[model samples]
Target: MTTASPAPELSLRDKPGFSDLQGVTVEHGLNTQDMVVNIGPQHPSTHGVLRLVTTINGEIVKDMEPVIGYLHRSKEKMAEGRSYFQYQPTIDRVEYLSSFYDHYVYVTAIEALADLKVPKRVEYIRMICMELNRITSHLLWFGTFLLDLGATSPFFYAFREREAIFKLFEDITGARMMYNYFRFGGVNADAPPGWLDDVRKVINELPFRFDEYEAIANKNPIVMDRCIGVGVTSYQDLLDYGVTGPSMRACGVAQDMRKTNPYSCYNEVEFDVPTATEGDVYARYKVRMAEMRESIRIVHQLLDNMPGGDSAELRKLEKEHAKVAEEIAAAKKRVTVAKKNEEAPNAADVAKMAEKAPELPFDYRTTGQKVNLMVFKPPAGEAFSMVESPRGMLGCYLVSDGTPKAYRVKWRGASFSNLTILPSMMIGNLYPDLMAIFGSLDIILPEVDR
Candidate 1:
């Protein structure tokens, strides 16, 4: 709980990799002029539709400015126009790769405002989904980052693992990407039968999968030559720019919200916050790789110690189970009599009768308390909920005027803040190093513009 001393004010000369270039001027002959080149409004390495306006003097970037908003969807404004339930689905677009983090912040904000007490099982479910999402986001970053550095096979390898986790997500949330699963008090539904066992199986295999990824790109010459010592940033720079998540941890900050703030079930889990002192592209890459392993460790703890069933909804369903089971047995006996009476029962008829059977409730409940989401309105107040997303600290500020729709909804995206330090990082570097620097930051544009 002790606070660290404030960072000292640093000059441009104090910046790593920029010190030698401070007083030195690039000498391009009269034949060569400072040329302005546009990297992209459409390019692969940008990670999205983003343009970097760069002034290069003979392959040396003299200046660079990120031109954003090409992918703007006015997500904050849409929250105002739509009801709380209506706006929940759109929350996925804020940060699609790790949308669970987005949903967690939004849902928790309302949960806090309304004073909803989430059950232990519900908290465990949210924690599992969010940690799995962290792995998938980092997997995509690992693959795409290596691809940016001129390696292709790792991209496919990364997706192979990512898709496996997504399949588990699909089994639970019924969607692969934009899973609007997390709700105000709980989740949309309970985990399907045998789903927890399936999750354990997939996560068990992930450590081996991570080893395969590291084997490919860890010591590769192309990766090292492009990433190491490139886009070097200091701790002061990270603090000044409001950089967070793995990018901030790379600068040796260890400022993860999960560890420091401890929302949801994060306080109960045991895991280390991965950090590196180099504060370069390679450092960021290394931090994210280590974080994925920590996420697996967190998942292992959550699954092993998950709370057993105490869902009120399940209790209610259990009360009606005996009657429903009796009715199903009577219906099956009628079907048996019909077969004896020389009436042919088709597969469709048998399936229709089978639908009446009572299903076994999930071992762990997905919901804590039930609320009619279509007309949910919290008391007049403001609450800011934050979570350690795959990228950085993702926060949602909600102001409720005792209405179903929020009075104000604002997002503090880590990408937007992380992207601010890019121009400063690229100013003294070579033109080709842009991909290495930007890719390492993992700037997803939808979250940036949202």
Candidate 2:
């Protein structure tokens, strides 16, 4: 009693969802039991904090279940407390890889509630940013997925191409990844002079880099062996679980949001939705690769036909500007007199500025007209907006109860549904192929647990 007896040799054994291996007897008098393995809330290939509680017998997986919510930031709940303007920054945390899509859906939801009219140029800019964001996301996926499959060089190669595009994003948005650029009616700011030229330059260069990527990895034996015919998902399986994006397209159903349900000037451009009938790891890989090329094609079309006024329209706007200049001078004089008398600018003084302000062509008006952001509110209504994110259909559902803050916000993240089919797919497969199948879905945990 005094010696403590070595703490009774503590062993964590025989728990639910797990059992000690020593308890089972095989036909040849060998003892065996299914082993439970925890893959991670920190595994490198999971792409975020995602855990797989798997039960394996020998080298084959008998059951696999995803334990999510590790990376949940409570984005929907956060929106309920914060004002619309205050909440924009946090949307980046929900889906950091292709965050433009998040902004697009969220902002469009608000725009619909308020019935805001966005300019054509703003639509074009948003589309360009979104499409480029897709390329960057897919490129990063292409890199990491191959790296997950035991190839190292493609990681560096894909990122090299991605860095050039990130520089373009940095120049425009000030922040590289978390860009709070989109506003309700339009973008936060205009594209600077020569920005379009820079975009044209980079997009022109990407195809060759893609060709180089294809040459190296498209038909590589190790990649092909690991990818083709593995983790097959049918089109009906996608529908049953609400899967979309490349995974859905890989099953030969063309369900791209850009094509099927046009948004943000996607209807103005023409691009084919790339598809494959196999619905396996190789098919998903092919679909994403093809989508990158298609995104580039869309960027070119959008840039080539950027919305702007003709020379005649420019001349007409200039004439209007000259007329406003005279009115503005008179208005400024009234303001000066009021200031000298130590009086605040009255309603007439405020109206004078508004009356004098020239109406710029929508093409030149990069951002929306001024609206008070500090205490903004939308009409009492509900809206559901969706965008085709790199992973799948990302939807934002908003309810406005005629208050400055939202009544509710709901995020339909693709990863949540895509991951649902994982356990079913993994049940009978060899254990090592887990990465091959899961990585192909391009599931990011933040998107799932948002």
Candidate 3:
């Protein structure tokens, strides 16, 4: 009747969302302890100032909550105060791993608001830079991930390629890490002298190196044991969680923004979207590795299909342009009669004239009709644009009031949403598998916390 005096309740004081008895389990007829542990706001495995508040019983994780916002830089609010051009430099820090994608979404949003036309050469250049960037981002992820898995060789090999690519970036962008190169309708400058040759050289050598990387890790027993059959998430489950990028691809969805949404010059390129059906850590790893190879393929096509012409044709066009400039200078010398009244022209006629204007040759990049950034503003409107960033669908939403400052600006970093699935994937899994599971997601914290 006393029920053996009823055992006293044992629980931690004021733990959030979980009770001690809820996660605790008995093994071999002995009671086990349920402990609450904080993985990090500073640990290496957390990868950029993320804290995982995890609850575990024995070796199995019961529940986990991600704590972010440690690296918040007030990016959107700052956009409201800075002019469009003035904000270019700041975008680099938004997602330092793939800053070009950030610049593309933001610049394209403004271009849409203003109905600006981007030159074919500019688009091709942007696409090449972006694809190269995708490779670099994936390379970094590749190295760090293997390091997380206790393999150090891939990190060095990965950085070797990264350094070589960074050299190309520095020559063209004037900065290795923060490019700040994409303008609203063009890039900061044309590819520097012989820069295209350097690109071709690097790209030609990458395929072989990628094959070497694959040989090193693909069938290694340690890697397969740790990654395979772990962190399984179905395609349907991923959709419910709003996951995208390699995580979604690992679930065998083949969802890539470059293919489905086709931003920048992506519509012009042909490449495969790799996928896997297992939807586990190994599947995610395979998806990313294939993506790097696909990225190299995309870069090769971009170089081959680039819009530049033969050197002889470029010289002849340059001469003709100089002749036209001389004639214009002579005309300016004569006193020309000025017209009065400046009546509005017909929109139809203007459209017809625009249609008739001959396009400049490939070497002649569409540069300045010269809109200065300090005073630049788009018409009062809103625009949303997305791109296939390395992590996932990176997007930007901008609202302008026909003023130098944006009325509102919102960033859609993939890391923010991708991080949400962590706890769900971790629950009921072994605690030691935390690094393998979290590294597979490959979330960057700046984007998540920003």
Angstrom error of the Cα, residue 239, model 2: value is 1.1
TM-score of each: 0.83, 0.86, 0.87
lDDT of each: 0.86, 0.87, 0.85
lDDT of 1 by residue, 243-330 (tens): 8888889988889888898888788889999999999998999999999999999999988887763234455676688677776666
Error of 3 at 442 (Å): 1.2
Q: Which candidate is the best by TM-score?
A: 3
Residue 225, candidate 2: alpha-carbon lDDT: 97
By descending TM-score, how would the candidates be arranged? Answer: 3, 2, 1
Residues 367-447, candidate 3, lDDT per residue (tens digit)? 534677778989999999988899999989999999999998899999998999989999999998889999999899999
Backbone collisions counted per model: 0, 0, 0
Better of 1 and 3 by TM-score: 3
Model 3 pairs in collision:
none
Regions more than 4 Å wrong, model 1? 1-31, 309-364
Per-residue lDDT of 308 in model 1: 62
Model 1, position 198: C-alpha lDDT score = 86
Q: For residues 1-450, what per-residue lDDT tens digits would candidate 2 score against the true structure?
A: 687666554334422333444534242333456789999988998999999999987668889989999887888899999899999999999989999999999999999999888888888888989999999999999999999999999999999989888888988888889999999888887676567888999999999999999898889999999999999988888889888889999999899888888988888888999999999999999999999999999999988887752334545676888787776765666665755646645657667677758767666556565666779899999999998999999999999999999999999988888899899889989899999999999998888999
